[model samples]
Target: MTTEDSARLAWFKSTYSGNEGGACLELATTPNAVHVRDSKKPTRAQIVFTRQSWAAFAGFTGRPR
Candidate 1:
């Protein structure tokens, strides 16, 4: 998506993210995909993932190491 397209997305930070300004990320989701970007540098590059791919990643990360 273009910068303008992404700008219109309803981005929100992860609930786990703290307010202390450490590492943090924001995410925006659509029916088909998910968008992720650094909360501190929203204007920079962002990574987009298919919903299935994102769900797989989230499932893996949710598992115990």
Candidate 2:
């Protein structure tokens, strides 16, 4: 990803992300897409999800603290 893309990306860690920094999910919002990827591999192929689908997933997963 280019610096512009990286800079434009606003990433959020999954609620389930471990405090110890193990496996974690990173979320980034784009104008027309949402980017999902492993924190451990920020440069790897990012999984793109639509806004609606992402919302559905978040709802389905729910918040489990």
Candidate 3:
């Protein structure tokens, strides 16, 4: 998506993020894709994932590879 499209998303930070300047991420979801970016740098490029791919990744992460 274009910058304009991304600007329209309602981004949400992960609940796991703390205020101590540790690793933080934000996510915004649409019917077609999931947008991910560093919470500290909202203007940076994002990693977009398809619904199926994101679902698989969400399920696989923090688990044994």
Candidate 4:
């Protein structure tokens, strides 16, 4: 996505992220994609994943390790 497109995304961080942040990430979702970026560096490059791929990743992470 272009910088302009990224700028239009409503990015938000997890509520668990405290004011005294160490390593936090932000996410924005669309019908087709999920955008992820470092909370401390919003201007940096983001990682975009298709909705299906993101769902799979989320599901995997939720499973017991």
Candidate 5:
């Protein structure tokens, strides 16, 4: 999606992000894809991944605590 489109989604950051001074990721989930971006630089280009791809990545990463 374009940056304009991504701006419309509700982005969420990990709990650890605050503690680490924004050194973390943020995500916006949509029906078909998940949007990922750096918490430190939200306006930068983000990565868009299919729901299935995101799920596999989450599984491999073991989900953030």
Candidate 6:
């Protein structure tokens, strides 16, 4: 599999991410993968997740059932 460039990663902060930068986690989603990275280290190693796995993880963010 080919890894993507940090610069090319289109990072999107959560709506909770205010100007204070307390919530700095960034996410990037591609055709078959989702990426999670620290906004503080946008140029460093990023966590990769398969589309299916990401869907599960993202679902948890909605509510703790």
TM-score of each model, paired residue for residue: 0.86, 0.72, 0.81, 0.80, 0.78, 0.72
List the candidates ranked by TM-score, beginning with the highest: 1, 3, 4, 5, 6, 2
Residue ranges of candidate 3 with Cα displaced over 4 Å: 61-65
lDDT of 2 by residue, 1-65 (tens): 66468656889998789799799999888777788988887877788888998888777856674
Give me the runs in candidate 5 sitting further than 4 Å from their true place.
15-18, 61-65
The lDDT for every candidate, in the order shown, is: 0.92, 0.82, 0.89, 0.87, 0.85, 0.78
lDDT tens digits, residue span 28-55, model 3: 9999999999977888899999999999
State the lDDT of candidate 4 residue by residue for 5-62, as single tens digits: 8889999986667778688889999999999999878888999999999988877956
RMSD of 4: 2.4
Q: Clash totals for all models, in order?
A: 0, 0, 0, 0, 0, 0
lDDT of 1 by residue, 1-65 (tens): 78898899999998889999999989999988999999988989999999999988877956578
Model 5, position 44: C-alpha lDDT score: 95
**The best candidate in terms of lDDT:** 1
Q: What stretches of model 6 exceed 4 Å from their correct place?
A: 1-4, 61-65
lDDT of 4 at 60: 92
Model 6's C-alpha root-mean-square deviation from the true structure amounts to 3.1
Candidate 6 lDDT tens digits, 25-53: 88888998988888777777889999999
Clashing pairs in 4: none
**Over all chains combined, what TM-score does candidate 5 have?**
0.78
Question: How far in Å is the alpha carbon of 41 misplaced in model 6?
Answer: 1.2
**TM-score of model 4 vs. true structure:** 0.80
Candidate 1 weakest lDDT stretch, 10 residues = 56-65
